[model samples]
Target: MQDFTRRATFGLGAAALAGRAFAQTAPPGGIPRAETPPFAVTPEPGASLRIIRPARFVEPDETIFRANAQRFQDKFNVPVRVDFVGWEDIRPQTAVVANTGTGPDVVIGWSDDPHIYAEKVVELSDVAEYLGKRYGGWAFLAEKYGKRHNTETWIGIPIGGNMGPCVYRASAVKEAGFERIPEDHDGFLKLCLAMKKNNKPIGFALGNAVGDGNAFAQWLLWSHGAYLVDEEGKVAINSKETVEALQYLQALYPAFAAGTLSWLDPSNNRAFSAQEIFLTSNGVSLYFTLKNDPGTRAIAEDTQHALMPKGRATVAPQTSTVMNAMVFRHTRYPKAAKAFLAFMMESEQYEPWMQGSLGYWAHPLKAYAASTVWTADPKNTVFRDAMENRFWSGYRGPISQASGAVAADYVLVQMCAAVASGQATPEAAAREAERRAKRYYRNT
Candidate 1:
């Protein structure tokens, strides 16, 4: 496995080039003429495809994505069907397909999923490499998620990322005596405390939500300079760093809205919509939900987005839902599956789909940083660097089956919940998390 420390440096360099836009032109519904490389794969005689992926949070995201799928079908004369399930169900459904080998030919899943089923998925090095070179190369985290642990072999094509930023009410924050959300840990904690005292509490998911819950738990751990494992892949969750994280959570939990222990992916969204909470961490969907409704226009106007506060860690400890497209080896139409993926990633389709998403899905390729979506609205700008700022699921370690299992099992969420809910002390919670994490990393 490549050392993630070095990868971080490379990622910063790629991020620096994000603002330099590529100027390639393409005919309608065709690949860019100047950068186009011949995709020579032929579909099978009776080609058909089925794909399973997480449902969209924004309506336009679904509308544009389905339209792109139809475009592929129309061009290729092949049948295509796509199934959209809840975010929490994607992993289990993909697992079923991997185990039975009789379900969808393509599975678009979250972070570390390709690593978990690496052997069961077909290599897509051609598709990935072609797209990277055609666009301005893949972002650092995207390349890391798509490739196998220790080699350049591609197991998936990174589609994009679902950025989970700290979406808050600017008015409420200002009312709490802060001009803006704080960028440092100490100041942020004070802001949260003031919000709670003012009866405008913050909320974050602590339940088993696959997206928001894991994102928050992982950030809390990482921001405090703790990790599930070290760069060497040894279990490292029981250290003082972890206990300090839990201790921090203990101090912060009282400032959260009541019943946050049971909050799921939609909980904060619902709470914020009803004015039950003033601040929370969420996707742009939360803001769009308000903007699209006439009754909540005021709330939408007051909404603001920011990256999570940096902690003791050198880099921002933000995590996101990375979407990856992988073809199963059991597919009857491997070529067709790969071709469809390539078609969807083409700028003609991808750019519009990204624009329609309204910043809910951030681009994984460096070229997209210059897309109009980022500049379309001032609030949308923070998500523009989500791919550059995000840390992979298993930070400081190689992404492997063990890392996938640990995330899927919700070890970090459970640990945070235990301490925040007073079911366990920080020390006990860290030790328990260590024990559970070791069980998964033991063999790997």
Candidate 2:
């Protein structure tokens, strides 16, 4: 067992570099450091823990995650090796690594990875229990993604997730004759049509953005009370609700900016910042970026955030960007890997580390949501709510490897893209999505 002390200082060069493009979102106040008494772990005599994660584009996040890792490595004399894979490559790369049983001992993953690679990873029940007891219980959706279906076994340790609030130009919205942003499907549709008539259309990507595109498609479908699978995990992509969703998209397609079909994760962000579109579904990154730059600060000030408009269902957004830490079954240093995770989640480290990202990341625990970061800014509070309202791509169904497969295949995005491009009718597109989902489910 060993005790660790919090490092009073963390570098912010990365955040400064990244924040230059967006207004700083971290609360101006500071957090008091807390001490962790002790914890036991059996260190592998000659082995080091290797961690692979998506390299964060935000400067602060890059600094926080990596600096802490290095500090942990130095303090315990347990060398930690970290490899940052790109966002586009992480899932498939992880699958390949997991399949071969040869890669990092620990990994920071996104989406439904816990289910996708359940057999290849170690059960993280111990870490989950510890964190839950130490820092209230894990969030509902966090637990949802980490646990194995119909079992209490945890597939990974939930750390954090991102929110996809509708970031829009409030002034532009007002200029279009709306006093406030619409809260329902009908009003939203009218607003978009108005904006299009004004030559300032809303932008929603119809491309293969693993995070943004997936969220866009799921948010629209779920808003209309449609789901890709039934509650029992059966294929159910073709329904009145789904057809309605597709038809809505078909109607809304011409209102979007050109080049939406070719969009990746960065497209909407770029388009929004460049003022090519007035509104889009994205994380806080774009809003923050607009705020930071003098050239776009006015747009940032005129910016207002909202949850996805309600359709026939609830007025919630289904966030797809989740972050988790997994310890692989092949690790020769399981104890060390768990210890590393334990260190990161401690209140003193976790709070400030998250703060560095300036509200770019959301809390996985209920307790941390009370932090000033969410309270200091109204927009932060709105963005943070996206975490609570989250539903992954396989909503109303089990988040199995099959659902993960569907996402990895970009099935939903492609289906929506087909109809948006007029290559397939709403019914035809819905049927195609259903067929593809069935194939993935059947193989799984």
Candidate 3:
């Protein structure tokens, strides 16, 4: 899911566009053209986005995010236009665009942070349910998860998704003398100890920067049978399960690549790429790590991906679909905007989205998931099976907004840094994290 190796699947299958799925009318690497009757949406014909990026993607295919406005316009029979801006000027220039409300028909690619949720993004509950029922009721998962959110609003919908429990080279684990993947929390720790004796870092990202750590930590904490919030919607990181997961990681840290504290997306990715670390509890970014990079791809080629080893924590990964898309309150054409949003949440729209985002997003609409196509696709359906009664919109806590999330990535990193650097004890770090979480929830 990191910027570097995640393939371009959204616009994939368009003729020869670098890496995306082929849509019906796609001309070799091209965007899918709308098959519906050419129904033009006339919104006074004024929509645009600063054709700029803060950190532009290296691949030329990345340009399609902006380049394809014409397709959206043609399909909707609207006169929407794409405005050009270099990355350097994009952010500052947004003030003028946003303030004037003369921006693009829909924003492209810059969604992250709670601002997207709180401000005006599309909510797909109705669409999710529609797609779910149409696709065989798997669409219900979206509304089930999205409904009654802490925010009293459905924030976003995921177009594609996958979760990795714990990834270890099967051979590496057996070489370390474990017969199979650990079945519980303690077994995982023992496996780590064994690997440490042989000098291998238990390969989960711990740098508390952003995406990587929160996701990794969530899987571990859930496996260990704990979470950031208690049953009372209060901070619970100090619970037994939390402590066990915390110490397990701390004890296993030294066996990992040196200076892991300084690690984030790239450095830790490099370690995994080089086969310097094994047994990372992470998502499927390993696909790229193993396939793309020249250095690590060789070893990664032989690695086996496995379900996250179960812990005393048996819960499924919490769905991020709760907050990826939102509808604008000020949308000039609410019906048309809603229609587009509706299309996005449906199984058909998501099929393309899943391939495009490289599965970084999961379908928030359960309706879309029930599609035979989704259930049948090897890559798309694995997580669907795991989602049975396992998914959560977000932590069931006082924090009302799904966007008001304190990702496990940041929490785990700060905790590890404390103990690894001798800056704090595991217990102390846990307590501080709890205190901070409590404050965050209360304020939110």
Candidate 4:
């Protein structure tokens, strides 16, 4: 609201994408400054490529996708066919296509398998280096997804990402507060606890939705000041940070609405509609939910979001970052496919296509992120803010996906069942999670 990003620095490491969160304030320069790459690139004339995207994304307008297709074709003397697919189907289907020699050159789907170094997708190291040479390089991919900063090999690019945020009723918080809403995790959780004592719902409901359960684990990771992985690629979730995070959740459960375990994203929306809860942490879908429901729309008119409260240790899972577009190994048009992939990651076609599709994806290209043209849209600003400070859960590397039964295995799901139902002590649940995650850590 108050030029949020301009004043804040995000990523915790150097040469890491997180650092890009802060605007570079010029030092009393009577001298003019150089332009940022994201803001400066021009479409390559006679430069075009073919790209296949997830079908779920809204296709381009009669004007943009088609005209651009022709423009790239005419300019680069290549054809760009834009295809779509349901995200779930894109991977296996793409794999089959790749295996059968019929897959698309580029894919648009969720998750980035960084550990799978030689898999179908491209590692961004070469591209990151190229961008570094041409334009200033920020760790576009490094700091993404809570990964240790500045190591090499990025599997996915962030197109549009969602952050774990506490979307709350502004009016409700003003009603509960001692003046000035707190952004610290402990303070906010305390408020949630107090609200519950008064029989007020804290807006948390994850029933029937693995996503809410999924989000709960992530918020816990952030609050605990622990990470899923350590710098050495070893799993670290069983440590102090994770246990502390579990305690935080256990402490807050009593204050959540009565049927919280049954709460999903919709439950929170329902509570918001009924004016029953004060806050809940979740992704951008909360905005979509607000727009779709009539009663919620009224509540939406007053709802506000903040980055999920920062723990003493700063962390948040990169939800929806690391979009992968791979060149199928058995493709008929291998060279074209590779070209298309390179181009897709390039900003020229990337920006307009996603924007035209009404896909609220953030720019995956490091250069595109610096664009004033891209950030000029206010709808994009909060996203821009979320990107710098946030990260995706480091998904399994491209060679193989994590065997994480995320919906069922996610720690939050277990915590809610344990703490909310009074089945176990918070400490007990934390110990159990550590045990389960240790197995996953070994395998992953």
Candidate 5:
């Protein structure tokens, strides 16, 4: 996989150009021609599949996804059952499936999940490679998440990412003495403090939020040039860099709205929509939620989006909720599962789903950058490059089972929360995080 910092320079213009080129030649309702043969895997007789995935954040996400599933069933004559659960419950449910060896045939799960249960999941290289060849290719982060550590084997297929950028009120930002959110950390902090001084405070999830908490904590850590582990997958969260990151959090925490210490994934969204918070980090769902409601139209109109500001890293270091599709080895219909996965990713099904998502799910395939979802709203354009700018869950290290365990345990989120809430000092929080992280990374 390419270094995301270097790949960040791959720029949206280049991606858009490539997308246009692919669109020009693509057959209507399908992918363009490829030298590789089409996916020809045959489903087994009496095939029926049960899939588990996180519930949708936006209505269109579920609507389009279920419709696509129905299309697959209508075309293949295979019965498909999909179960949507809360995002926080997904990991534990997937773990149950992995341990019991008899549950859902397919699991559409979050980052590094397939890595955690790699041994129990069937390889999908054929499915992933075929889609990559047809759709131009997977984004750099998509390829990283799709493949296993130190090998070409693909344990899962990346569906897309729920990208959480900096969503804020434009007038509030201007009232705080900034024309726009700054791209550098000091300026960003000053803007936050200014917002608080002006009585329009910012807030991000600091509790056990599966998405928002992790995104904010990971961005805070990585932006300050810290990581839970180094490239060799060794625990390294006790350094001065880690302490500095925690201390930075301490400075920014006071500018947040009250009760942020207990805020969950939906808390910030609700707070932002109610005008209780002037700024937050969230998917475009927040904006659309406000837009679709007549009562909140003004707030929706005031909303704007930007990438997270850079710190010592001087690069985009945001994290996202990456969704991956993995088939269990215990499934009675592996070919059927693979075929279904392939069918969902084809241009016919994927393009409309991507657009219908209203920019909530960032595309994993490079070709979908041309989707009008990004162009229809200028505020959404920032997310089109989310996969390019994001670092995987285990930054500076190979994503593995340990990385998955660390994320599942919420070590980074806890460390940030501990320091921000004054439960621990910066140094103490870093040391505690180090000890906790080692429990998972020790074997690595």
Candidate 6:
């Protein structure tokens, strides 16, 4: 499989720090790279703070981020260099620069990134508390994704998150003889089975889909009351709930289209847009893409989103990316970095940024929920209640380096894929996954 994570491109601007391009070259892990748009901020003489973040998959959203950073620079008179890295490479890139004390002053990364770089980043308790008090408090998931378990330290500030609601063609569901979408596990299975009769197979990423695959797999396991680990970070995958989850996946495997096992983040998007798929789990990116394109407007109009169906247990699906901004201790301008983050969080700046995303970025702050963006569309509102359901890969386990390791390695997704492909029995897959997880959680 092509390494989607390594295929990230850098966006270097003319005003980039020291005129050096942080653009693409294969990093240590065999990850590939690409270059993004030019650097957005033009640093003044003697102004030298730099921030690195994942470039949005949507080009317009990336522009919004750059514009917002420029706002910070114009207001604070601090020339901030912003480097937008690819989603697959951001974590590793952050790790490399952070450990060596030479990365950006600020970084925006996915869930558990704060946990992964907890020691190397500055404690953000003061910043978090200030934001919490001023913004009517952080949402539960924000707190969960931003801080270490059982500690007062805030490793990063949860800004916003990307949601993975079940995106489907509403027309397809009705054609399959369902009055509404499935609400329970068995009902959902029956719907998929029905959809299969017409060859409109349900699609979920089975391969190295860093976001969709992991989020959907965890949702399946959690719905069955299974957990990858216990609350304290112990390996707890070998169980009835887990076995049932795998078996459930195996039963549904026949309903998935061919090549699903190799799908990455962009695969389902293309499939849905082309009308080749009836159902899949993904963010609003697919919807937004379709909506913005005149040629695909029909598909966009027909698309709808909902929460993952319930199983033996009722819980919200785990979010794929709980986005946060981290400041490194090695930053020569810690104060400037913090100010930039805080300035960006203000309602004036944050709302417009979310608006530019067109429902792709949901608010991590409760107060921001009242933004018109959430109510502008049915697809957006359906995900409002889902915002609080977000959980990192560590879920029942503590968010630590071990939990981060498991997520980065795509452990649960691989386990489910193994069963679905008949490569291993559910029991064997569960046991092997447990063994692998034990190795990751060894020190924690």
Give all candidate RMSDs, comma-separated: 8.4, 6.2, 6.3, 10.1, 7.9, 8.3
Q: How displaced is residue 78 in candidate 2, in Å?
A: 1.8
Which of candidates 1 and 6 reaches a greater TM-score? 1
RMSD in angstroms, candidate 2?
Answer: 6.2
Worst 10 residues of 6 by lDDT: 19-28
Highest lDDT among the candidates is held by which one? 5
How well is each residue in 1-444 modelled by candidate 1, as lDDT tens digits?
Answer: 101010011111222223112111222222233366567676777899988777777666665677677767768888878777777788888899899988999999988899999989999999988888877888878888989988999998888887788889898899889988787778999999999999899999999877889989988988888888878898888999999999999999989999888977878888999888988888888887888888898989989988888888776688778888999999999999999998888777787777766767888878888787788798989888877765778777889989999999999999999999999999999999988998889853
lDDT score of model 4? 0.49
- Give the per-residue lDDT of model 5 (tens digit) for 1-444: 101010011112333333333333434333343566779797888898888888777766665677677667768889877677777888888999999999899999997999999999999999988888877788878888889989999998988887788999999999998998898889999999999999999999998888899999888888888887888988888989989888888889889999998987878888898789999999977888888888888988999988888777767788668889999999999999999999988877777667766768788888788777788888789888777755879888999999999899999999999998889999998889988888888864
Q: Which of the two candidates, 1 or 2, achieves a greater TM-score against the reference?
A: 1
Please give the distance, in angstroms, between residue 187's alpha carbon in candidate 1 and its true position after superposition: 1.5
Model 3 agreement with the true structure over 1-444: per-residue lDDT tens digits? 235532223321332233222322323222222343322333344432122222222332243332343344446664433343332243344444445655543433222322323455445455544444454543333443344444435544333334444566666788788867766666767887788777776766556534455556666567677777754566667777767777777776666666667665445555666667777754445544465457555565566655655666454443332223334445565445545545434333445444443443444444344344334435434455433435442344433332244542155557756766678777888888787766655643
Relative to the true structure, how large is the alpha-carbon lDDT of every model? Answer: 0.82, 0.76, 0.49, 0.49, 0.82, 0.74
Q: Any runs in candidate 3 off by more than 4 Å, and if so which?
A: 1-21, 25-70, 78-126, 138-141, 148-153, 292-301, 315-323, 330-336, 345-349, 352-362, 365-394, 402-405
How badly does each model clash, as a count of residue pairs? 0, 7, 53, 28, 0, 9
lDDT of 6 by residue, 1-444 (tens): 111232434443433222111111111121111232322333344556777777666654555566666666666678767776766677788778777888678888877877877878888777777677776777877888777888877888887777787888888888899966676778889888888887888899988777788887888898888998888777898899999989889888888888888887778887877777889988877888888888888888888888777676656555647677898888877667767777777665666667767757777777777766777887778666444774557778888888888888889989988998899999999999888888888853
Query: If scored against the real structure, what TM-score would every candidate get?
Result: 0.91, 0.90, 0.71, 0.65, 0.92, 0.88
TM-score of 1: 0.91
Clashing pairs in 6: 6-32, 8-34, 9-34, 10-34, 10-35, 10-36, 12-39, 13-38, 13-39
Ranking by TM-score: 5, 1, 2, 6, 3, 4
Candidate 2 — which pairs collide?
14-59, 15-59, 15-60, 22-288, 22-289, 22-292, 23-292
Measured with C-alpha atoms, the lDDT of residue 383 in candidate 3 is 52
TM-score result, candidate 6: 0.88
List model 2 lDDT by residue over 336-401, tens digit each: 898888877766557766776767778776667667878777887886654566476588788888
Off by over 4 Å in 2: 1-39
